[model samples]
Target chain A: MSTKNSEAGEGKERAGDVIVETVARLMVPFIQLFALYVIIHGAGGPGGGFQGGVIFGASFVLLVIAFGIVNAGDRFPEGANTAFMSLGVYIYAGVGLLCIIFSLGAAQFLNYGFIPLTTHFEENRALGMDLVEIGIGITVMAVVTSIFFNLAWKREPEEGGEEE
Target chain B: MIPSLDLVLLFLIVAIAIAAITVRDLLSAIMLLCAYSFLMAVIWVEMHAVDVAFTEAAVGAGASTAFLIAALSRTTRWEKK
Candidate 1:
C-alpha cells in the first residue's frame, strides 16, 4: 500500500523550483482562455484555429515542463487524445456532408451557407465557418499535444526492454 | 515597415542563421533557431501578412523549438567532430 501511494505521488512531483510550478499552475487557465479567444476571433482578426490550437497545446507543454510528463499524461490520457483527434475530423466532415444533404446535392462541399442553422444565409455561413474553425482547433491541439508527449516520454529500459 | 528596420532585421536573420549553423553545441543551435523563427515572424508582420506571421510564431518558434529540444534530449548534447 505504501509503495502504491508513493508511486502515485511520484507522478505529481514538482520538476523544478516552487515558483515555476506556481506560475505554471496559475497561467494554464489564462492561456487556455486566450486560445479560445484566438479561435473565436479568427474570423475578423489575425488569429485562427491553428494558432489557437497551438497556444492551447503550449499550455500543456508548460505544465509538463513545470510538473512532469507523467502527470500531464495522466491528466490527458492517450485515449482522450485519440478521441479528440477523431472527433474534430468528424465534426468538420459532418458539417460539410450536412451541407450537401440539406441542399439536395445542389451545394458544393463545405458550402457553409447551405446549412440552415440560421434564417439568413450569411449568418449560416458565418456560423458554419466558426464551427469548422473550432473543429480545426480541436484537431490541431490534440495533434500537437500527442506529438510532444510521444517525443518527450521516456520509457524504462527494464520495464519494456525497448531502449533504442 | 521602416526601411532601415527591415534591413536591420534581415541582416540579423542572416547572422543568426550563420551562427546557428556554426554553433557546435546542439542546445545553442536550437536556441538560435528559435530566435530565427521569431524574427522571421516579425518580418512577416512587417510585410502585412499577419496570418502568416501568426502561423510562424506558433508553429516555427513555439512548437518546433519544443520539438527540437525534446529530440535533443534523447541524443548527445554536443555534435561530434
Candidate 2:
C-alpha cells in the first residue's frame, strides 16, 4: 500500500513539472509578438529600438530559465544567433551606406531624406525609422541571449581548487 | 487625472526598484526585479506608450523573470549578507 501511494505522489510531482514546462513554452510566441509590437509602434509610443530589442532578447532568456539552458540552446543554435546579430547590424548600416552611394548628402549617415522612400521625404523618414527599430530589436535579442548562454555555461571553479 | 496616475506609477516603479536592489536573498531580489519591471510598464502606459508597456509586461515580467530564476537555480539561492 505504501509503495502504491509513493508511486502516485511521484506521478503528481512529474505532472506538475510538465505543467510548468508547458506553460513556459507557450509564453515564447506571445513574448516575441509583443516585442515586435513595441518596435514597430515605438515612433508613436514610449518605446524605441533599444527597449524593444532588449524585450525580444528577454524571451529567449526566459526560455533558457524556464526550460533548461541546454534545451534553449538546442532551439537557438550558436550559428543562428550570430547570423541574426550580423544581419541586424548589416541592415542598419546598409541603409546608411545606401544614402552615401546615392550622393544625397554626405553630412548625415542615417538621414532618411537622402534615400527617398516613394519619392517623399516623410515616407522615407518613416521607413528609415521602422527599419532602424527592426535592426535594433534583432541585434539586442541575439546579443542578450548570447550573453545569458555564455554566463550560464561557464564552468564553476571546483571547491578549494588552486587559483590559476 | 492622467498626471496623477503617472505620479502613482512612478512611485511604484521607484519602490520596486529599491526593493529589488536592497533584497538580500537572490531569489527575492529577482522576483522584486520582476515587480519593478511591471511597475515600469505601468509608467510606460501612462506616458501614452501602449506598445512599450505591452513589451515590458511580456518580456520583463515574463521572460526576464524566468531567466533570473533559471540562473538562480544553477547557483546558491541565499547570501551571507
Candidate 3:
C-alpha cells in the first residue's frame, strides 16, 4: 500500500507544473501555424517538409513534456497515427504515379509538370511540389510522434514484473 | 557570419561534444548533445546553408533530443562504471 501511494505521487509529479502546462497550451497553436507556414514557404525559403514536420512533432512533444506522455498519447490515438503514416506515403507516391498516368507514361515518375492540375506547366509543378511537401510533412510528424510514444510507454508494474 | 562568432560557436560545440562524452549522467549527455546540435545549426546558417541549418535545428536539436530522453526513460540514467 505504501508503494502504491508513492507511485501515485510520482505520477502526479510527472503531470508537471502549472506554469509549464499553461505555457504549452498557449504555444501549441502558434507552433502548428508556423509549421504550416514552413511547409508552404519551403519552395522559396529555408524551411521544408521535413523541418516543418519536425516542428509540428515537437509541439506534440512539448505537450507530452508539459502534461505527461500518457495524456498526450491518449489525445493522439495510435490508430490515427498509423493511418497518417501510410496516408502521407500514399499521397507522396500517388502524385508521382499521377504524373506518369496522366502523361500517358511519357513523363517519368514525379515529373510534377506532367500533372494536369493547372493549365500552365509551371503552375502544375509548383502545386505538385507543394502537395508532396504536405504529404512528407504528415508522414514525418506521425513517425516522430509514434517513435516517442513507443519509446516512452511504460508497462504497468504488474504486467512488466516491475521495472527495477 | 562574423569570424569571431563562428569561432565562438565552434569552440562551444567542441566543448559540448567532449563534455557529452565524458559526462557520467546519461541525461546530461543528452542535453549537451542537444546544445551541440543547436550550435551546429547556427554554424550551418553562417555558412549560408540555410536549408541544412533548418533541418539541423529541427531534427538534430528538437526531435533527436526528445527521442534520446524518451529512450533514456526506459533505461537507467547513470552510466555503468
Candidate 4:
C-alpha cells in the first residue's frame, strides 16, 4: 500500500510541475495588475490595504514556484528586498506623522479633518483613507513577499548533508 | 443557512481539509491545504467579509502553497507513520 501511495505521489508531483509552469506564466502579469487595481479601487469597494498587499505578494511567490527559488532571489536580491520593506514602512508611518503635524484639534491620529487639506470633510476623509490604505498595502506586500522568499530559499551544505 | 449551495461548499471545505491532513505524502498534503484555503476563502466571501476573503485567497491559497511546495522540494516527502 505504501509503495502504491509513493507512486501516486510521484505522478501527482509530475502533474503539478507542469501545471505550476503554465499557471505561473499566465498569472504573473495578471496578478500584478489586479493587485494594483485593488489598491486603487479599494477606496470605493470591498477591497483594501491587506487584500491588495497579499495579492502583490502572491505574484512573487508564484514566480518562485514556477521557476526556482534561486531565480526569484536573483531577480529580487537581498538588498532590494530590504529597501522595499523599509520603504513601505516609512510610507505608512510617514502618513500618520504628516497628519499630526498638519492637523490640529483632530480626534486622533489618521484623522483627515485635522490636515485641513480640503474644505469638504468627506473629500479630506477620502484622501486620508486612500493614503493610509496605500501605506498598508505597500508594507503588507513587501513584508509578506520577503517572508515567502526567506522560506522558499534553502542553501545546501558543502559536506553533502542538509544544512540545519 | 439552509441553501443547497452553501451546504455543498461547506462539504467541499470539510473534504479538502480532511484530505490535507490525512495525506501521507507531504507534497500532496500541501497541495490539498491550498485547496482547503481556497474553499475557506469562498466561505469568507459567502459570509460577506470580502476583504478577508481576498486576503485568504491570495496569501493562504497562493503564497502559502508556493512556500510550502518550495520548502518541500528541499526535504523528504514521506513521513514515518
Candidate 5:
C-alpha cells in the first residue's frame, strides 16, 4: 500500500511544512472551480478543455507535491483513473456516433446540428461542442494525471507475470 | 503595448534558457526550466493568445515542474561532469 514516494523513504523528503500543506489544501478547491469555469466558458472565452483539464490535473499534482503521492492516490484512487481515461474517449466517440445515428438527412459525421435537441441550430451546435469539450477535458485530465504518476513512481509488476 | 517590454521579456526568456542548460545541479536546472516556461506563457499572454498561455502555464510551468521535481527525488541530483 505504501509507495516509495508515499511512505518512510521519499515521503519524508517531499512533505512540505504544515503551512505549505494547509495552503495547498485550501488552494486546490478554488483552482478546480476556476478550471470548471474555464471549461464551460470555453466556447465564448479564451479557454477550453485542454487548458482547463491541465489546470485540474495540476491541482492534484500540487496536492501530491505538498502532501505526498499517497494522499493524492487516496483522494483520487489509481483504479478510477483508468476508468476516466477510457470513459472520456468513449464519450467523445459516442457523441459522434450519436450524430450518425440521427443522420438528420446528412451523410457527414459529428454534425452537431443534426442532433435536433434545441430549437435553434446554433444552440444544438453549442450543446454538441460542450459535450465534446467535456470529453476532451476528461481525457486530458486523466491522461495527464496518469502520465505524471507513471513518471513519478516506479510500478510494481503484477502477479501472474506473462513476460519472460 | 510597449515594444520594449516585449523585447525585455524576450531577452529574459533567452537568458533563462541558457541558465537552464548551463546549471550543474539538476534541481536548479528544473527550477530554471519552470521559470522559462512561465516567462514564455507571459509572452503568449502579451500576444493575446490566452488559451495557449493558459495551457503553457498549467502544463509546462505547473505540472511539468512538479513532475521533474519528483523525477529528481528518485534519481541523482548532480549532473555528470
Candidate 6:
C-alpha cells in the first residue's frame, strides 16, 4: 500500500477499534485450514477441486475486504498468481505425460497403472485422482483471485458521474 | 427435501429476489441478494447436495457480495429515478 493511504487507513482504523478487522484476523486462519482440509479430503468426501479452490480464493477475498486491495495484492502478487496458475496446468499435464512415458510409447494415455506409484491398480487410480484434483484446485484458486483483483482495482466514478 | 421447510426457503428466496430488484438503494439490493443466496444454499442443502450448498454459500453469499460491495464503493449507491 502507498504510504499515504496506509497512514490514512491506519488512523481511521485506530480511531474506531476496527471490530471487523479484528474478527476477520481471528477467523481467517481457521477458514484457510478448512479449505485445505476440503482439498485434501476430496477423494472420500463431498468436497473436491473446484469447491476447495473457491474456498481458498474466498480467503484472499476476505483479506482484501479486511485490508485494502493493495495489501492483499502484496500478499499474493500478480506474478505469483500467474506462476501458480500455469504451474497447476503443468502439474496436471506433466502427470499425463509421465503416464505416457511409463507406457513406453505403447500404452494408453493417462494410464495411471503404468506409472507404478502403488502396487494395486485401484490405488494408483486413486493417487492420480488426488493429483488431478490438486491441480484443478490450484488453477481455480489463482484464477478466481485474479478475476477479483482485476475487477476491484480499477478507475472509480468521478464526482457527479452516473455511478449507479 | 422437507416440503414445509423447502417451501419456506423458496418463498423467502423469491421475496428477497423481488426486494433486491425493487430497491432503489444499490447497497441494500446487494444485501438482499446475499440473503437470497443464503436461502438458495439452504434449499440446496435440503435437497442433499451439500457440495452445491457449499459453493452457493461461498461464491454467491460471500465472494460475489464482497465484489459487488467493492464495485459499489466506486459508484453511486442511489439509483437514478
Q: What lDDT would each prediction earn against the true structure?
A: 0.88, 0.74, 0.88, 0.75, 0.82, 0.80
| Candidate 2 displacement at residue A11 in angstroms | 20
Model 5: lDDT of residue A157: 45
Model 2: per-residue Cα lDDT over B1-81, one tens digit each: 287887878888788888878878999999888888888877887787776677788678866776676577567888775
Best by DockQ: 3
lDDT of 4 by residue, A78-108 (tens): 7787787777778777777777777654536
User: Over the stretch B1-81, how does candidate 4's per-residue lDDT look in tens digits?
Assistant: 336878999999888888878889998899889888998888888878887888788778877887787578557899778
Candidate 6 wrongly placed segments (more than 4 Å): A1-16, A103-113, A155-164
lDDT of 1 by residue, B27-78 (tens): 9999999999999999999989999999999999998999898788667899
- Arranged by DockQ with the best first, the candidates are 3, 5, 1, 6, 4, 2
Query: Among all windows of ten consecutive residues in candidate 1 chain A, which has the lowest summed lDDT?
Result: A1-10
The stretch of ten residues in a row with the least summed lDDT in candidate 6 chain A is A8-17
Candidate achieving higher TM-score, 3 or 6: 3
* Candidates sorted by TM-score, best first: 1, 3, 5, 6, 4, 2
User: Considering only the true interface residues, what is the Cα RMSD of candidate 1 after superposition?
Assistant: 3.5
TM-score of each: 0.91, 0.71, 0.90, 0.80, 0.88, 0.84
Model 2: share of real contacts kept: 0.25
C-alpha RMSD for every candidate: 3.6, 6.7, 3.1, 6.1, 2.9, 4.6
List pairs with backbone clashes in candidate 2: none
- Any residue pairs clashing in model 4, and if so which? A103-A114
Q: Residue A110's C-alpha lDDT in candidate 5?
A: 81
Candidate 1 per-residue lDDT over residues A134-162, each given as its tens digit: 99999999999999988876655465475
The fraction of reference A/B contacts recovered in model 4 reads: 0.62
- Considering just chain B, what TM-score does every model have? 0.97, 0.89, 0.94, 0.87, 0.95, 0.97
True contacts kept of each: 0.75, 0.25, 0.94, 0.62, 0.62, 0.50
Model 1 / residue A122 / CA error / Å: 0.4
